[model samples]
Target: MTLAKAAAEVRERAWVPYSRFKVGAAIRAASGKVYAGCNVENVAYPEGTCAEAGAIAAMCAGGDYKIAEVYVIADSPEPVPCCGGCRQKIAEFAGPDVRVTMATTDGKEKTVTVAELLPGVFSAAHMDRA
Candidate 1:
């Protein structure tokens, strides 16, 4: 299926009871495989991660380190960009030019590159040896 379709499909499964805010993400890897994930929330709040992060984690588990494209869908009118943590997680697998798309339930959409989303991003490469 297409990235948009996958994202929407995942969005339908989001488990958000507290805020009733649902979001979904679809990640395409260099291998031409796509993984879909929906946000899973916990009552603990901060413990919950975005659907993008979950998708990236699943992709990493399968040894795919190159995200070709990433799409996110949310229920809001404005496009919801990945959080700081998710952006860092995305950088761990995708390249600087990795495609990132954001969409709202109202059909509004926007596309950006990973580097564009997180300019001057800090990565593990910046870490020094102990």
Candidate 2:
């Protein structure tokens, strides 16, 4: 399935009883496989898992460490951007030039590269002793 279709399809399965807000994410791994995930909420509020993180986990479990592209969908008036944490997680697996597409259920969409999404992102490069 296409990234958008996979995200939209999985969105219906979000476990968001607390907030009633749902989100879905799909990632195209460097292996050329598509992995989809839906938000999973917890009673502890912020303990809930974002869809992007779930999708990234699935990609890793599927043995793909690199992300080629990403798509996230939500039921909002406008395309919803990834949460701060998800942006960093995505940057860890995707190149600075990788495209991330955000979309609303109503058809509105926004696309930005990883660098644009998280300018001055912190990476392993910062850990180098040299």
Least well predicted 10-residue stretch by lDDT in candidate 2: 42-51
Clashes of each: 0, 0
User: Per-residue CA lDDT of candidate 1, range 1-130, in tens?
Assistant: 9999999998999989888899999999999999888899999977776899888887888788789999999989799999988888888888999989999988999999999998988988789787
Q: Show model 1 residue runs off by greater than 4 Å.
A: 128-130
Clashing pairs in 2: none
Across 2-108, the per-residue lDDT of candidate 2 in tens digits comes to 99999999999999998899999999998899999999999987898999999999999999999999999999999999999999999999999999999999999
Query: Candidate 2: global Cα-lDDT?
Result: 0.97
> What is residue 16's positional error in candidate 1, in angstroms?
0.5
- What CA RMSD would you report for each candidate? 1.5, 0.6
In candidate 2 the C-alpha lDDT for residue 123 amounts to 99
